[model samples]
Target chain A: MDSRKKEGQMKTNDILEKKSTRRSFMKKLSIAAAAGSAGLVTGGCVGGSGSTEEMGLKWEEYFKKNYRMMTDKEKDETVARLEKLAKLQDDANIQMSNQEPREKVLFGYAFNISRCKGYMDCVEACVQENNLDRNSKTQYIRIFEMDSGQQDPTSGDGKYHHEVPVENKYYMGIQCFHCENAPCIKACPTKATWREPDGIVVVDYDWCIGCRYCMAACPFWGRRFNWGEPEVPKEELNPKQHYLGNRKRMKGVMEKCTFCVQRTRQGKLPACAEACPTGSRVFGNLLDPDSEIRYVLKHKKVFRFKEELGTDPKFWYFMD
Target chain B: MKKIFLRSGLFCLCFVPGAVFLAGLPAMASGGGVMERIHHAEEPYDSMAIETAYQQPVKTVRAKESWQGGTFRVLTRKDSITRFRCSVCHTDKKVLVKDGALFTHDDIVMNHGKGENGLVCIQCHDEDNRDFLSDSSGKKIDFDHSYQLCGQCHFRQKRDWLGGAHGKRDAYWAGERVVRNCTSCHSPHSPAFKTKMPETYSLPLDQ
Candidate 1:
């Protein structure tokens, strides 16, 4: 009878040991999952949970101030954080423009409204060029076709589709005018929106406090604010990047047309101008009287948008 | 002495009317005629404006000296008046017999009447519609000879022409192909190209 009791006791002990082993395995798995999620959030392998306020403190601080006032160390840290956030959103490789002083490179664009055919080729090109987040709202250029004999540019319709050479319609493509005297720049108390020396107006994604003052100030209605994390696929991301232009902006920042400064600064034309079949969008030195813009102004009866307003817009239009 | 007095009286009568016309005043047609009919419909000042605006310059060719080799052309006042009249191109004196005949052209004539009765060059070739060119040899060339010259007045049509969206060309895909001039579809004198549509020639699809 003692021998029988001893055997039963041995079986019970085996069952208990197996149960203990299963519990330990489950605990390890839970810990590993928690560690992975924390890594994704912090970009570090160390596992821990932090409150939203604690996690976003650095980003919030960076966003609160102007980029011009940021120290060299702060700027580097901000850029690094942005890069990490971009990578976390998409595993795709990102190449950021290493241009220093980042403020001096100004870019500008002038489109000939007379030549635009409402082809939407530039719209498609921008989507591919910037690797826009497909799920969210993003549009680089909005072309509106006004009725014949109508002087008001705002009187046109936006949706159009068909073959080339659509008649009796005057197409006005509205994008970032990158004005020399941008009201948005003046309105931004934080100086988030500033003009570069090359004539491109840009927004510091990290420095923008989401005040939306720039959006209100823009006369052309060119600014777009990201409401959520931009969801872009990794493969389609453009590795060629620029600091002031399309380097994959973050959530809650205001963005607008930069005249494709990244490409223009590198001696290349804007992607929209390149994709245009009719060569409507003319990009060149406004300072150079010998440029195509100069020829257009000299030969054609060029008119600007709201000329009475004296915005001194670089964009010019003439009858074809 | 009697003959000289009569000539002087006639000269005075003509001079007074001519002076009035030059001073931005419409010349009163003798016996209340067609000029009066048209003038009555328009404002008096506007009629004068139109008459003054329509005044033409005379053409004169001066004989050149032996050293100069070529004669220089200058316009005289009487010649300018004649050039301004419809008789400049339609030299047939009978055609300009009626005073109102100078203003008639194919597009302007309201009534067709009988065959070719309404056709006139002045009808279509108004100040806004006139487009002409002079060749190197001093020959007046029509729109057919130079399409671009015709485009100056017709800005919208010219744009289509340059973009290859209007006018007929030799091929579809190949860009390097001969294209027809404006005169192929339009006559400068008539300027009503649409009138020749369908009846004169059908498009390729219609054919």
Candidate 2:
């Protein structure tokens, strides 16, 4: 019995020694994992590989920097920093042009709602034409189809798709109704969003301090604020960049439809107007009386959007 | 052994019904039913020969009218024949024959070639031309439908309607929608463009 007790004690001692060794090994492994994570965070290789300058900025500071206020040298450095930050966020080398001047042009659009077939082709085309971050919830056109007998024009919603030629439905396409007396322009203290000579409303992306006052001031709900940096694949990116439209925008900035000004200023129609299968949308100089739009106004009964607000929007609607 | 024999007997019982079902398949495939007989009976009209025979003498017509001093006059007949015309497809039950002789002469002179096979209205419009009867709602059954009546000669336009390329609907406002019929935009006899003025025509408020 004494020998058996000694043997049991020896076995106990051996088991305790083995357990202590395992515990020490586990402690060392945990310390190494923690140190490695700290290194990754400090080296700017975590979540996104954004530059130290961009990474250190607070969300508020990111919103407040006005691109226009910076000198040429400052702008160049800032653009380079932003490009590096974008690469880190995407984990892919992205080519970003901070030197490209914003191309501003006068542009307008008119929708004859009576002719729209609610095909959603314009909505799809806009998504393709502009390399919108698929995950970043940005949309340029919102089509609304209200019940046929709804007096309120706002009742029409465009977010729909089904069979070809839907019956008993009227389609109303809504985009940034660039107002002549834009309240968004008034709200922007930095003058980031402003009206142009050709009646187009433009945004100076760099100058915008991301004060969402412009978004609140827009009466038509036309503006969209980017919550995160836009993520577009390299292949899908619209390489032919424009200042007023189709330029990739960063996070925390306000964007609205530019009426495809990048395409229109080059003597081409807007993407939405071109994609319409039925000639429901007529686009031309409101100044030219001989234009099809003029003919429609002269012969057919026509009305502008929200005329009572006195914003003097360029968009118009008419019946066949 | 007894249980195995009983299970086999039960299998045969199920197989007999299934075999009977299979045996009936040939009869079903032969289509020995009333629907098949009726379909087979409709063979003659399905023949190309009969279709050509019916089409050969039918007249083709095109007519236009011009308005002058609140009155309209027939311009000219593009083609002229005196038999089996538009009246072959359309019956003249509700004839607007006020002065029968003058009407027939003017119609024949103006729309003689306007029918299917260059036949005049009088050729089929007469009492004996009774084969092309239409299922109409009215007492005398003049034409099948307003569009069908027009379709007898305007075949292409009729095909377009079936293909959903052409039709008329009411003007839709923000809340209220209304559809206007074909006759609202066209005149049967004159075939002239009509200027559409609203029911309560008012000058623009700005004007």
lDDT of each: 0.53, 0.51
Instruction: Considering the two chains of model 2, state its CAPRI-style docking category.
Output: incorrect
Best by TM-score: 1
lDDT of 2: 0.51
Candidate 1 local lDDT, A1-320, one digit each (tens): 23223433542443355566656875896688677655566663245454454456443443333454456776676666656555654555676663442221223344656666676778777766776656663776777766778766566666544443356767677777776556787688655777554456788876678888988877777787788877666777777777677887778888877777666655455777767655566664443332334445555666776655534466666654
Query: What digit string (tens of lDDT, one per residue) describes model 2 on residues B1-207?
Result: 999999999999999999999986543343232122222332111111212122222222221211111111111122222343555544656555575654354552333344565543333332444423232222221321334445566666444333212232111100111112233334444443322211111111111
- The residue-by-residue lDDT of candidate 2 on A1-320, one tens digit each, is 23223433543443355566556875896688577656755667555655565555422234333443456676565555555555565444544444331222223455766666666667767766666656754667766665777635465544444543456877677778887657787698766776544456778776677988998887777787788988776776665445556767878887878766565554445676767655466664444332334445555666766777656576777765
For each predicted model, how many residue pairs clash, with residues at least 3 apart or on different chains? Answer: 12, 29
Identify the runs in model 1 with alpha carbons over 4 angstroms from their true place: A1-65, A70-89, A100-108, B1-207
TM-score of 2: 0.46
